[model samples]
Target: MAAPGPVHEALAALPLVDHHCHGAVTADLSAAQFASLLTEGAAWPGVSPFDSPAGVAVRRHCAPLLDLPRHAPPADYVARRAELGWQEVNRRFLTASGAGVFCVDTGYAPYPLTSPAELAAAAGATACEVVRLERIAESVAAGGVTAGGYATAFEAAAEAAVRRPGVVAVKSVAAYRTGFALDPERPAAPEVARAAGRWLARGGRLDDPVLLRHVLWTAVGLGLPLQLHTGFGDADLRLDHADPALLTDWLRRTAGTVPVLLLHCWPYHRQAAYLAAVFEQVYLDVGLALHHTGPARCRAVLEEALEITPFRKLLYSSDAYGVAEFHHLGALCFRQGLAGLLQDRVDADELSLGDALRIADWTGRDNARRLYGPPVSEPARDSGGPPTRKV
Candidate 1:
């Protein structure tokens, strides 16, 4: 690896604001459990996730934090993790991430996970909430609300959820639930009641397109930044419907509403860039893809996302769930990858050093601050470096 340049040093020293992420698991994970969390895909009997890019990157980057050598064997790494226990592992990784703030999605949890306060304490950072619309809707259904009253009940629930202290934003997993290819218009009262009746009867995950559109429009009414999971998720998502471009018509209809943040956006990062460029209310981050693509390929992904994206419209996030290693790995990749790309531009005289540094600050921290409010705690600054200018 090359030595750190001025740009790399600047980014390395900057504390990041992870605009979207989830809590790390509190309990110790068995080898199989750990393997399952490593990949978005299911763990097969013969194949190990350790051979993949994300797995290799974890060994190469995260092993050293556990007092093991870089690129340690998978068995050795897992054993070392078990030996250290969950708390110590969480502490080492989250603290090493250098993120000053974490906006956690308190929605999906198949296993017991840390709360926002707990996660923040482990990382020594401030934490806020990003309420999941789908989860709230599911809870409303589970409560046995009448279909005719469902819309009113859901809107009230969503309103109350966002009013909770420390709640910064609301999110929709429409891509996973029904994708973005639905009617651009908000569902009418009768349509919502019909959809609710069907969903309540079926009693499964909320997948009704009408209801998904309703929740999205409801998010717009709430007036907080709205995050939509755009591309690159688990098997539940149909990749074809997950493209950010698929929401172009809807984006046009809702233009000037609450900021719509497109999360992940791998393979379709270029499309996301186009949206951010054209839509004032749009922003994006290639977060989960960062740790999965790892350091080596993260730059390419970042480059494409930044190709036409407005400087202030890009933010940083780990989208990390379950494992704490992703918190550290995501930050590492963002700093190293972004620095390399911006530094190259500076070297080529395509961009000035000052502009490069400002772009770094905007994407890493300031953009998020501008979207959400200021951090609960003052952001931690690195000891010695050229001062970063604030936008």
Candidate 2:
């Protein structure tokens, strides 16, 4: 690789605020378990995830950090990872990620994963929590709240969850639950009661559309930035329904209520960019997609996402769950992809150097700081290694 340009240098030095992500698995993973986590799909017979883009990316980008050669064989990579143990592996990658603040989603832990504080400690960074609204709602139902009392019980529970110290935001997996094609307006009390009754009786994951809308609207009332999963998730999601464009009416109705962060809009990135351009409260990050696209295609994904997005509306996040390699890979892809795009525009005279540099800082760090407030403690500057060159 050639030397990094000025924009690259600036981005390299900046402390990224990973505005949305999940905890890394603290336990050592077997090769098969690691492979399953690489792709959003299941590990089918006669197929290896290592041949896929994300799997190849781990070998190409993350192998060397484990003291193995770049593009190392899958067996070699997995062996080295186990030899180093999960803690040391996590320390190496999380430190290398250059993230100063991690806003961790404390929901959906099928595995025993690091807590926000543990993740921060491993990286020498600060941490904040993003309460998952659906989890809270589920707990309310599990606690045997009546349908008539579900509305008030859920509201109180959500409010209390956000009030916990270090909680900076809240999120909903509505895309996975019911998608975004529902009525835009908040449900009436009786409507919510009926919906809650049906959901409580069924007693499973919260998927009722009326209840989904109710939780979303309740999030609006909470007045914290809300993150929504938009596109390209596991096999459970219907791709067509995960489009951010489907939230048009909801965005319109909830204008100026709370900042709604659209997460991982890959196939619908163009739509997400449009939403960010038109709605003042809408923001986005192509986090989960970054590592999956890998370094080779990351720039193209970012270019499309930034096509019409207001500079302030684009934020950085890893959305990294399970493997620590994603923490490093997400940051690596983001820095390389974004710097390549902005630097080219500068070279083409389409953007001034100062503006490009400022955009890097805003997208990488400041925008998240402004939204989440300052970290619990100041972020460590040394975690990312030395800058490529001083800004």
Top candidate on lDDT is 1
RMSD of 1: 4.1
TM-score of each model, paired residue for residue = 0.95, 0.95
* Cα-lDDT of candidate 2: 0.90
Which digits, one per residue and each the tens of the lDDT, describe model 2 over residues 177-244? 88889999889999999999899988998999999999999999988889999998999999899999
At residue 335, candidate 1 shows an lDDT of 96
Model 2 alpha-carbon miss at residue 23, Å: 0.5
Candidate 2: which pairs clash? none
lDDT accuracy of residue 329 in candidate 2: 94
Q: Once model 2 is optimally superposed onto the true structure by TM-score, how far is the C-alpha of residue 173 displaced, in angstroms?
A: 0.7
Would you list the C-alpha lDDT of every candidate in the order shown?
0.91, 0.90
